[model samples]
Target: MNRFAALEAFVRVAETQSFSEAARRLRSSKSAISRNVSALESELGARLLNRTTRSLNLTEAGRAYFERVSRILADLDDADRALGQLQASPRGRLQVSAPMSFGFLHLAPAMPEFLARFPEVDVDLSLNDRFVDVVDEGFDVALRIGALPDSSLMARRIAPIRRTLCASPDYFRRRGTPQTPEDLKAHECLRNSNVARTQEWRFVDENGKPSLVAVSGRVSANNGDALRIFALSGFGVASLPTFIVGADLRSGALVSALDRFVPQDLAMNAVYPHSRHLSPKVRAFVDFLVARFGKRYWDPDDGRP
Candidate 1:
């Protein structure tokens, strides 16, 4: 017999002081209940009940074990109830890792609304441009941009991350816009140091064939926002995500360079440890992000942008 089942039957029989009453409460046969209690007593090497013709009674040993076992069962039930409640509602501290620039410029603004929708959840957000191991770092979820490497973790695409070669209007006016990918060689390009090929910028032609252009820049920074600021200050052209430069492009603070040569659109993905049985907080947040950004709302061509 299962230990838990036997213990439960023993506890119920002790409480009601009658096998018939315990069986009725448990919706089981009285003989099955008696057998379970007997098995439990045999396992414990002690008599648990004082059987009589008229009434049932608990032995001293039975009474002692009942007190402790009843408390344990109650606590177990409470824990199960708590877990069910948590599954039903997103409540608890959700640990998240995200890129510094995107976190501040995008996610930070959307968080207030998410919190408003799920008031019981608190977000513990960490912003850094470095790659974080979602499982090893103990993050409940992570937002990543670009092509993801092969890993054990599961990912869900949240938005399209479109890259554009752009510069501030002042810089473009001074240097003139690059009409083609090769033309960028003559311009003072600002490089994002984080990329694998710091000096090469990629673009796709009209035929959808991708090409890499070798270029040099005076300013190179590891962080995208730093490169963005340099471009804003009219330093040079930079390849940046539309999510970062979309507002500027709309406001005429920046202008798209080499518009004919389209850059490949990457993806913004929400990564977690596993796909199955995800916690309520992580699932809610990822779903929220998908609904909020999956349509590439940051694109200048988008009506809202």
Candidate 2:
């Protein structure tokens, strides 16, 4: 191993205090990281890392060397960032991921314009519903929805979203409209199988007490858009995101049930690894999304219906 390469690995190990964590962050294997550190120790003739089965520590010499090398590495990173910023154009292949149907309906429409605006960027976008390992799989950014799992990944809200309880006027006319959250239990509801528990639909009561209503349905679908279509055809009551059903609600094609008990908030987020220096391309795309679709995306009073 080269001198500075070993120093970099040693510094990461020292900072993270785990060879495995340092390896994960560096996108290398634990054995490779351990081997590099050992090679550094062999070349310097001084053991830099004090390792154990459970923990790691830096030797006295390693501490002093770390104090000096940290500043050098910081300077190099700053210089690299500075030079990267100086480039007049962003020129690289940027990989992005998003949900399948949303990518088709919203994201895809804007891409041609974005491409025209930035000739230097070549975007590689992957559309799927499943969560992807961005760092391991080499994605630069991922557009996410609903509750994000706690992780090192960074997220920014691109728009607002809420799972609105909706039914067609025809169904409501026949079955009678629900006046309160409790009434949903008696109604015929279409379940979203994608939800964690298909049998329960959650809502916040008037006092802000959280409640789950056990709902039953004859037809359940994994796709939100399909469930929405079924609801439109007077199949049953369906709860779906505002972005998916907002326009229909405004046009009177779909009407909300138990509107008073509905939660008013959720978010559409742009997620990426929580790196100190995020690329301008990712930053640009998120800003573009926010500018295009803002906080009042589903405001019922808005003309979009």
Query: Which candidate wins on TM-score?
Result: 2
RMSD of each predicted structure: 15.5, 7.3
lDDT tens readout by residue for model 1, 1-305: 78998999998888777899889989999999999999999989999899999988888998888867876775676566655755588989998999999899889999999999999999999999899977535688999988899986789999878788888888888889888999998999888888799999888899889999999977899988888898889999988888889888888888887766866568899998753356778889999999988887778884432
Q: Residue by residue across 1-305, what tens digits does model 2's lDDT show?
A: 77777777887888778898889988989998888899988988897878888778989998887767765775667567865655546657888898876787778887888778778889998988888977546687898888888976788988767668899999999999998877877888999787689998888988988888888989898888899899999989998877778789889999987766877666778888654555667677777778877754555664432
> How close is every model to the real structure, measured as TM-score?
0.70, 0.73
Residue 267 in model 1: shift from native, Å?
0.7
